[model samples]
Target: MTLTPQDRTIVEATQAGLPLVTRPFAVVAESLGLSEAELIDRLKQLKAQGVIRRIGAAPNHYRLGMTANGMTVWDVDDAVVDSLGEKVGALPFVTHCYRRPRALPDWPYNLFAMVHGETREEVIAKRVEISSLLGKACRAGDILFSTRILKKTGMRLRGKEG
Candidate 1:
């Protein structure tokens, strides 16, 4: 979605984070020189137009003792990936799971799963459990452990509106 000048500014400001206060939106409004109601209305309009999906926290899982986050890639039967993907996605430890095209000549993994744990051992165990959950439909996969935290945020105003 194309952003209005106001929308662009608000989104950029909040991308860093919401203010820590009882009235975070009011702080945003003050910084933008807009009334709280006006700021909220613009946000509402953005949501209605599907420019913004959801406003939520990008929790620091590592700092919260979840130091190991494994990006588990899977090779699964296309027919059953969807139903099983939903089950995997619903897992609290599995922060994300989605199907992508089978990796090309250089890439082999297609189904992606994200599982967070307190240690590498725990993360691997989670993957083993996932494998059992998938049963025969799951062929093979690999686990990539996260070592550092990059920036995380909500929707971007620049591209890929969703």
Candidate 2:
């Protein structure tokens, strides 16, 4: 999408992430020489125009004492996968969940949900809870624990080189 010069400036100013201060928008707006209200309005407009998907915090799960992270994969019956996925995603321990296309032959899991806890055993217990919820709809499943942390960040706008 084509962003206006001003919108581009706003995106560039905040893409690295908003300030960790109490008044983050205000800080960004000040840096852009715009009022906080104007910055917020423009952001809302950008979202409406599909230029921005969402603005949210990406917390560090490990820092929050949730060191054990497991991505549970399930071979769910396609007929009810979507409906069942919604239920699995809503679980308290599930940090994120979605459906993926099955690889077949080698990999047949079509549903994935991430669970986090203080330990691997805790994560496994949460996986059991998910399995119970899936019941007969889930045929096979497995859990992959995270070995290392990865940096996460939002989209960034590149500046024009004159």
Candidate No. with top TM-score: 2
Backbone steric clashes in candidate 1, count:
0
* Stretches of candidate 2 exceeding 4 Å from the true structure: 1-5, 48-53, 154-162
Worst 10 residues of 1 by lDDT: 153-162
Give each prediction's root-mean-square deviation over alpha carbons: 3.6, 2.2
lDDT of 1 by residue, 12-120 (tens): 8677678889999999999999999998898888888887776777778767999888899988888999998998888778988999998577767778999999889
True lDDT of residue 117, candidate 1: 90
Clash statistics: count for each candidate: 0, 0
Expressed as tens digits, the lDDT of each residue in 1-162 for candidate 2 is 788999899888878888889999999999899999999999999999988878998778889999999999999999999999999999888878999998869999999999999999999999999999999999999999999867565556789899
**Alpha-carbon shift of residue 3 in model 2 (angstroms):** 4.1
Q: What is residue 63's positional error in candidate 2, in angstroms?
A: 1.4
Work out the TM-score per prediction: 0.83, 0.86
